[model samples]
Target: MKLVIGGAYQGKRAYAEGHDSIQKWANGETCPEEEIFSCEGMVDFHLYLRRLLQEGKEQYVREQLIPKLLQENPGIVLVTNELGYGIVPIDPFDRSWRELTGRICTELAEHADEVTRVVCGIPVVLK
Candidate 1:
C-alpha cells in the first residue's frame, strides 16, 4: 500500500470520507499516543488533528498498521497533511512531529507506484 500522509486539511478529509472510522487501523485511532495527552489550544478537530499527525505517530502507523493493510489489501492510496513544509511549529513536540511526519510521507511517496497532491481537488502527480 502507498500512502500520502500530510498535515493539511482537505487531504485528510478525503481520506476520512472513504474510511468509515478515522481511528481505524489505517488512519483512524490506528495507534494511540503512547503518553498521556493534555488538551492544549482549542482542542478542536483540526488542532487535535495536527496533534494526531504529530511526528511520532507515523512510526506507529508504519509499524503496526501499514503491514496489515498490505496483507489484507491489494493496494491503498493513503493521504495525510503536509505539515512540515511551512514555518516551524512553536511547540517542541509539534516541531518534532512535523519533521517526523514529513520524512515518513516522503518515504511513502518515494516507494509509491504513484504519488500526487490535490490542490483545489485536482491531483498533480509528483512522481
Candidate 2:
C-alpha cells in the first residue's frame, strides 16, 4: 500500500490523483465499509475515520478495518490528513482522534511501500 499524508488543504489529494484515479471520501461522506476492500485507491481517509468514530466504530477501525483493507487490497493508495501537529485540541474526543490518526499513520507508514508528505502543494517522498 501507498500512504499520502499532510496538513489540511496541503494538496495530498492532488498529488495522489497525479498517480492514479482515486475514490474520495471527505467531510463525513458515508463509507461503504463492505466495499472499501475492493477500492483501488482512497482519499481523505481521515474523514472516514471520523465517521467511524461517530458511529462508535473507532475500535473496529483501529483493530479490523485498516488491517482487513490492506490484507484484501495490497496495492491500495490511501490519503489522509496529518492531524498530530500544532496545538492540541481541548476536547477529549478531538484529542483522541488526533492521537488515533497519528497512530494509524505510523502503522501505515511502516507497512507502506511508499510514504509521501505534501506541504504547500509539494510532495516529499518519505519512504
List per-prediction Cα lDDT, in the order shown: 0.48, 0.81
Tell me the lDDT of model 1 at 17.
Answer: 41
Best lDDT goes to which candidate?
2
Q: Which stretches of candidate 2 lie over 4 Å from their true place?
A: 21-28
TM-score per prediction, in order, is 0.54, 0.88
Off by over 4 Å in 1: 5-7, 11-26, 29-74
For model 2, residues 18-104, the per-residue Cα lDDT tens digits are 876565433225657664677777777777777678779887978987688778987888889888888999999888888888888
TM-score of 1: 0.54
Taking all chains together, the TM-score of candidate 2 against the true structure is 0.88
